[model samples]
Target: MLAEYRQFVLPRQRGLHAEIIIIPTGELKVNIKEKNNSLKAEFDELYFHSAGKETELVCRDQLGTESVRWHLHLANDDARELAMLIESAEEEFEALMRDL
Candidate 1:
């Protein structure tokens, strides 16, 4: 998941830039078995940002919670186009999750 995200954002830069941060929540869940009655699981949060503004993308999932934020600093063009691109990416991510 992390790799995919990096690939998605790292290649596109026409004067725009983005950053991704992954933070571990350090929380775990336990399950009952018999001999091995517990399992280890980890949760994390993902933050995405561009320009300067921040936006939340994903916040609830089995792998952990994630959020994406985007900032747009438009110089000559309208910011709406950039906004649309971010929105499209968000939707694409959601669809990918569903497939998983």
Candidate 2:
């Protein structure tokens, strides 16, 4: 059988902290830990723009929803991996659109 998608989990330092995952279908699954509550957002849209050492992620769950911006500090390797994932997502989206 052929794999339809790829999945990856972002590495973190440890302990209870926020985590991010790239789903097989290309969406982002993010979990944030708060003082008394945890919040999870499955973003259908992800826009990544990088400048120098700073990377900005614009995420939205759906159309007309308020978008959230996240500024992430990533190592060189991490940044490269993220860029690849974004590219993969875009490619997949385009392919799906063409297929429909």
Candidate 3:
């Protein structure tokens, strides 16, 4: 999971990049934006769980205090497929940020 985080995403230039930490519970966090004088648009307390064939991504925001959840199911684990998934995710995230 840590390897995936490091390989798939780059450092956030304007906001904050996703970071993975190994503590009491493995977690992932990202600072997506800022508001006022406080850290805003940050996602934390992320918990990833895998079912039989799907993975779940759950996260909470620091400022809005909202929770977002998503899931991914992979049919095959191949380099090309993985690349496409990462690229698609990045494009989607970028579009979302632009909309905000």
Clashing pairs in 2: none
lDDT rank, highest first?
2, 3, 1
How would the candidate models be sorted by TM-score, starting from the highest?
2, 1, 3
Worst 10 residues of 1 by lDDT: 1-10
2 or 3: which has the higher lDDT? 2
lDDT, model 1, position 23: 17
- Winner on TM-score (1 vs 3): 1
Q: Write the residue-wise lDDT of candidate 2 on 1-100 in tens digits.
A: 1112222222332333445556545555555443233233343566566666545555655566775644334444555676676567667777877898
- C-alpha positional error of residue 88 in candidate 3 after TM-score superposition, expressed in Å: 0.1
Reference-based TM-score of each model: 0.28, 0.46, 0.25
Please identify model 2 stretches exceeding 4 Å from their true place.
1-18, 32-44, 64-66, 69-77, 89-100
Model 3 has an lDDT value of: 0.36
lDDT of 3 by residue, 1-100 (tens): 1123322221223343323222212233233223222111222444344554444444455455665543223222322334444445556666766788
Best by TM-score: 2
Query: What C-alpha lDDT values do all the predictions have?
Result: 0.33, 0.50, 0.36
Clashing pairs in 1: 55-68, 55-69, 57-68, 58-66
Q: Give the TM-score of candidate 3.
A: 0.25
The CA lDDT at 56 in model 2 is 52
> Which RMSD does model 3 reach against the true structure?
15.7
